[model samples]
Target chain A: MLLDDAVLRAIMRGLHITGSFVLFGNCVLQGWLLPAPVKPWVQARLRVISQGSFAVLFIAGICWFVLQTVDMSGAQDAGDIWQALPVVAGSTRFGGLLIGRLVGFTLAALALWLGWRRGAAVLAGAALAAEGWLGHGGAMPGPVGTLLLGSAVLHLLSGGVWLGSLPGLWVGLRGLDMAQAAVLARRFSPLGVVCVIGLLLSASVQYLILIGSPAALLNSGYGQLALLKMSLLLGLLALAAVNRYHLAPRLPMGDELARRLLLRSVVAEMALGLLAVLAAGQLLQLAPPAMAAMLGQSGG
Target chain B: MKLVNLIALALLLGISPAFAHAFLAKSDPPVGSVVHGAPKMLVLSFTEDLEVPFCRVAVSDSMGMNDAAGKPQAVPGHPNELMVPLNIQMPGKVSVIWHALSVDTHKTQGNFSFTVTP
Candidate 1:
């Protein structure tokens, strides 16, 4: 059945963003979180996640491109450079974004193949970086778009490290040697720290873009939901801190209670993160600036 | 735990307001506004930059026919604004109907009436 345009766009955007999260998250987990003993398993899992998500993203992206092509042909500004390029090259904004995505996708595919062949980590990193650039960061224009793009990059990276590490941790607990698992956890911690920092920076930038003004915090539905997301993230951060400083140390000594608590907390954090993602899906549809302006006028 | 589940449900339900869009901010020659001279063109302004090609603005006299001289043209430099020239030259009450697809693909349509004085 033919879907409504808004619904279709929302689905496309959600698929793209979610696929990105999976791709980056899995990579971070493999590179930083998995211990050396279980590195092979983690690598395999990352490959699975990356390949699966990319397949979905590539298909959805192509569908969106086709739809956009049809729409652009009939566009009133059809003759403009921006509108002509996807069909012509170096023509329009949409064309630029499309080209960026194409380049990024190609790089990512090649990187995946190389990674499977035990390619250099640096090469894989470069491909992933390009993937980030083309997916959301490269699509943005101007200072605001640049800021948004940067945030999107961090969001993908941090989300990858946090969410993507879970399965590996679960597997390590199932059968791996205790000392090896502990060592892995230790190695993963520093990467987690870096990912957290990136997440916070990106999220802050995104918040600034969305909120735009202080009044928006209380005015628009989008703003209110964003505040809720922030609160949830703060709670998640507190839980993460506890996991890192308190629970992680105890795990090496085989403290059952600490392990249980940590597991529960991580699950909760993941659940909250999913909720945040869903909220974000909704927020992207809202008219933040207009709503904020309306609220300002009403308040005055 | 039940309380938490209930709260989550409430939050999910409360999220209905997120489906907002670029509504018609205003229109020049306000809907049904009586004017002295025949408007040379009809103009519409939207709250957000609309995706062109899928948007249209049409004007018709009392008979409910299209009075547009040719295809509607997007206002240059303003993707949100659409203009359609009027072909009629008489003092008659005209109805203006506009429909547009927002960048997000939300379809919106609205209509207004105005009289052109001889």
Candidate 2:
């Protein structure tokens, strides 16, 4: 069967998303850190992580997407999948996006390896952005599908900028002075708020279409996982609030302790972000709430 | 960010594939074909796997008499293949109606007729 072992599929999927998010977050962090008055060594380390991930994640993403082709065609086994791959990828919308993502990720990875950061950044960003073209939105039909795809894309990119950037933000804080740390915090707070707004707006609309009913969240596996992702998002927001109101102001006054505290919080948020990404990977494997109900009622 | 957004939009415009329906891909007694004689089974193949409980196939004679066939079941290890046993004591133009629900929960249905020559 295409995904005979559910656990194996989830693990592969989780690793794929986490890998992509790592690259995305690191790239955004690199942007944030470079403008900071951090030590050369610290900046160099972040650059190394970002560049290396761009390369690693590109290959990983392609393999994962290839394996993921089972989602489009109802291929029951590996042999069936292998036979279906060329035709399915050639014909389907999902295949088209996967191919695009593969090409974009490859070029981005190569550019980064060749020390072309700017080009890599653009290409890598595009690669991640195309994910909306697949997943739940891809399954949906009509103009509603287009709308959902747009929302999902915005949601993912905003997340890439926000949650994906957290690790770098945590690491970048280590090398900054109290004032620079405060300035960095100040710079990120507004951006975080804006991104959060985007996340909330998109999420609410997505919930309406994808979830259909709140009761499904409790009854269905897909719903339960979505709840977990939302919980993690809430935790991240709490940390952001803590940083914005409490730690950020403290940093401008040279509070070394507050800088340390803020770094810890960012790390905590980053951990949560990864968890959310993990859940998201598994979520995509599931049928949406209303659909899951139908599957249960109908599948013999 | 705007460029990224623009690229996604440009790439996705008008590219949505109209799939998700479990349309009939083939059949045992192919649609509208003239069979040599009465068939013992009615088998339908779909574009995707069928939810066995929700998918069913009904065979009937030209006089609209229903076949007391075996309950529809997906051919084991073959998700897209559904087969129904037939009690074809007599046949003229055998009509087959099928309704299939894919695992993803998309529903589709259709019917076709094939002549069973004397």
Candidate 3:
């Protein structure tokens, strides 16, 4: 059988995205949100998570590259991928961009090792932004291409700030006094709002550039997957609203019940965000409806 | 923000959605067309930028003999166009098969034929 499998590629892409979320979230939590002088135990655990996420990104990224090589070269088997690797890596724009992203990831690791939390976050964000070049946004031509790609980068960075930070919040809330927890939650709320606005604006731009018509939005597989992702985003936003408006306000009043509920809500938001990422992975594989319609005309 | 507003205005004004995936847009010989004489080259234009090294365009005569002169190459100024030199001297029907991998890693392929009259 051919080595080019869409399902496997999508799964690998999802894993890569998940890794980006975690690493980026970790950076934001460390540098921007969490108060300095964290408990040693908390710092240790966060460090472990950060390291683990890097490993996932590295492994999944390599696998994605291999799968892309197989798909691009029309390889028939394992051996063919080996022969095609150099040509794919050397001759293609995708290869060049992948190399640049790897370099960015490497810089992120070095920054973290040097205890430069802000630098690490910037590097991680840059790496995630480079992913825009590997998707539909990059394929667009001319000035509109720049617009689409910029929107994609903004969407990803906002997603990393919002969805990726959930774990940090989950971890930081543990064993904290109600007052401290409330303080932390309040600090995170404004960031969430900024991210939500960014996500909305960028998503709107992408929708206009990618789907355009209502018919295509409802009828095409890409559009349907996009809708599913939007649904998950809505779920996440609802859960975030509850945490920020209802539960967080009660935390400073020593409402233990509200604290527990907020934690659960964070968990729910993380789950929905993960599903959204997976949907995004699948969406990348399918052509947008407008392009699909053009393909249909040419019998592609 | 200004850029976004402009793009939104353009889209609202009915600009075509940006394209992805390398779908065959047109070809030099033209799919299923009859030409008076053999063309020196085949030019296949796609809707997106192609990864030239990974792309394949094969042209064969009715007897199943390869008629492509050498390896297919990218047209110098066209990122989406692939050019294959033709070696057909006497042609009844020439078959063309192609597989293209776009820069975004979307794959597409198709086949067509054209008749050449003596």
The DockQ figures for the candidates are 0.06, 0.07, 0.50
Which whole-number lDDT from 0 to 100 does residue A156 have in model 2? Answer: 80
- For residues A59-107, write the lDDT of model 2, one tens digit per residue: 5555665555554445688997897677646655555666777677768
**Which numbered prediction scores highest in DockQ against the true structure?**
3
Tens digits of per-residue lDDT, candidate 3, A1-300, equal 453489788878888888887888888788888875577767887888788888888788888889888878778988898999988788998888877787787788778878899999999998998899888768766677777888889899999899888887887776455666778898999999989988988888888888887788899888989898888988888888888889989988899888888888888888899899888888888888877765534323
Ranking by TM-score: 3, 2, 1
lDDT of 1 by residue, A163-236 (tens): 54554555554435566666666776777787777777777655555455567677777679778878877887
The whole-model lDDT of each prediction reads 0.58, 0.69, 0.84
> What is residue A175's positional error in candidate 3, in angstroms?
4.6
Q: Candidate 1, after superposition: displacement of residue A233 in Å?
A: 2.8
- Candidate 2's displacement at residue A217, Å, is 2.0
Q: Model 1 misses residue A133 by how many Å? A: 12
TM-score of each: 0.61, 0.69, 0.91
Better of 1 and 2 by lDDT: 2
Best by lDDT: 3
User: Per-residue alpha-carbon lDDT of model 2 for B1-118, expressed as tens digits?
Assistant: 5434543553466332223345677888888889887888877876555556556678888788886478897688777778899877675888787777654434566778888876
Question: In terms of docking quality, how is candidate 2 classified?
Answer: incorrect
Report chain B TM per candidate: 0.75, 0.81, 0.88
Please give the C-alpha DockQ score of model 2. 0.07
Ranking 1 against 3 by DockQ, winner: 3
The residue ranges of model 1 lying beyond 4 angstroms of the native Cα positions read A1-16, A31-39, A56-109, A116-161, A164-235, A251-267, A286-300, B1-47, B75-77, B92-94, B106-118
